[model samples]
Target: MTRCRLCGSEAMASVVDLGATPPCESFLAADQLDQPEPAYPLHLRVCTDCWLAQIPPLITPEETFKEYAYFSSYSTSWVEHARTFVDDAAARLDLGTGAFVVEVASNDGYLLKHVVDRGIRCLGIEPSVNVGAAARDGGVPTLTEFLSPDTGSAVRAEHGPADLVVANNVYAHIPDVVGFTEGLRALVADDGWVSIEVQHLLTLIEENQYDTIYHEHFQYYTVASAIRALASGGLALVDVELLPTHGGSIRLWARPAEVAGEPSQQVVDVLAREKAAGLQELSGYTEFSARVAKVRRDLLKFLITAAERGETVVGYGAPGKGNTLLNHCGIRPDLLAYTVDRNPYKHGRFTPGTRVPILPPERIAADKPDYVLVLPWNLRAELTEQLSFVHEWGGRLVFPIPELSIVEVAS
Candidate 1:
């Protein structure tokens, strides 16, 4: 992007240029495989002024979320994480039956369902019609609408101001960062708390998590940049928590400017860490593009060697990040026979640009492939245990990110 989405600056520097790829989640149907698939330049640039790394918003949220293929409930670990967060938040915020909780971009009511179970008043603001319907079917009070300043105000008026506003893994999704933060401000009561969980730029750079960089994520944030972004919309960062989810993420605790005091020591420490890592300068990003190339080369070499040796290699989980890894490495069905996922929506469909078939999770066991390339490597521990049955066939699991590593799962 020529200008920063979070800050109005033209001093953008290169972080990594991933060439061109289609929307990461735009899986193809069998009949539409022949149709021309469009691709966009998937380059990431960091603004020197604000230190916010972002890609151009070539595609809108509606294009991707209207009928999303991903369902949060499919990931057991993620559901448990949500449940733990709800329980902790309720006890920490002293939320009782009279307290109200609101979650933005509440996919399938994964988190809010816990609030409902606790007898707390809660509402979910979901954008996708299908997933929103699924949430309602599960007994969640949901509003099928995008979060804008106007929408936030309307919701606040209709159902009173929220005592707790929880936005997990969505702070980086919106293109208009300032407006979205304002919407967050409008939804919460004056003294109410807001918690946002987003992938930390520090972890993405250190762990070589390039697959998470896509058009859907308009911007990536370091704690220093996040503080500035939050201040732009009159929300003050009060505290911070380091989380292990999504490889590594940060949970920001904020409040209205009038009520928010000085940030906690945790925020100060994380900002110091980001600064020490040289993220705000060009030093930290110089070797990233090279590292990304290594990941692509290493994965391809392993796949090609397996093919030449007459060994079979299949993939596990058809996540959006997997599509990025597939397209970046130019992997096809030949390199990866096919991938399997727990989500039925992706069954029988093909990956966006890679065009690899997506089969049911059962296919891996039935086919008895020699190796299972784990696509959603972020969930390595969880998937490794679930796919441990492959040990019966002496099949191993392969992880391509954070350096290619293969291990045998013991039965």
Candidate 2:
């Protein structure tokens, strides 16, 4: 009986139930471990009405981001991606000293720093206190508040409408899709554009990326669904770009509906591709749960076998998606002795449900576990390169998503 968050449709179909899972980003300190951790049902439903896939908002953003641990700056490729976007956007928008830029969910000012470096006026709207403080410390002005219609209007009134607004991988995290999109409309100038990047649902289903499902991420979007969501808030989609990040993502460029902008061929082409993939129909999502169930079984079988063979398994990168995969598989310290992360914030903590202790990357070499599970498979190449030295000791690397397989290093 879960209703769609976007369309207010009660005729939603169950996609996949990932069972009970703790908030993916809720990394725990040692002191709080003795108390019981709360877990919520992680289920995704597709609205037969709007074709939007979503989960109920079981947790609030204020609680989820209070002391956020995930910092975008920790990923080198991600930072470079942001810099490249800034360079291209600045040139494309013909931005000068007077032009203003704003970024929503601007974690740690990873992208806004480049804008400030270019001598442009920029402000970041971020709700996570730790990350907002980090952004301020790094010389980027930021407001630690969630973007809603009211906050967005206030920001526009105080700072003037933004010439360019960027929201990367944040659109899906919002529970109030309509309100968030309306906020985007409010924050941008009439002629200004808003760019949002989200993981393409086609890739999620076709590529078996069920690990991306978690409480923090409330919804998934296809080009059609995105257009519908934007249109609900008086925005028009004018352009689109497909990116390889997060397995596959679509960067949507939108402008206020009142201002006419020619829709880019890329947008039409992507929409066509979505249609060809049957994104407009219910069957496109109904079959995904079966595929996801297979992946879950395969992963559990692999882990159980590894344990039976007396193999010491550990994990690399304690990402939000990693927590989902581990919690979905019901993995605990018994299956994964510990996980390592480069981020110091997560080093001494434990993952939410599985309670897998997170240690520094140096610990991977110190323990030399028989196998290293690359939980963040999206960065497999980068992680494999960093952990290549493990091969010297006959330790293997494994990726559980898409399919569970051992990473074969180039000979």
Best by lDDT: 1
Residues 1-411 of candidate 1: C-alpha lDDT, one tens digit per residue: 678887799999999999899998899999999999999999999999889999999999989888888889999999999999999998999999999999999999999999999999999999999999999999999999889999999999999999999999899999989989999999999999999999999999999999999878889989889999999888999999999999999999999999999999999999999999999898988999999999999999999999999999999999888888898999999999999999999999999998999999999879999999999999999998999999998999999989999999988
Quantify how close model 2 is to the true structure by its C-alpha RMSD in Å: 1.3
Residue 161 displacement in candidate 1 (angstroms): 0.6
Off by over 4 Å in 1: none
In model 2, pairs of residues that clash are none
261-312 in candidate 2: lDDT tens per residue?
A: 7789998898898888877877677788888878889888888899999999
Q: Could you tell me every candidate's TM-score relative to the true structure?
A: 0.99, 0.97
Candidate 2 lDDT for residue 95: 89
> Model 2 segments beyond 4 Å from truth?
none
Candidate 2 — what's its lDDT? 0.90
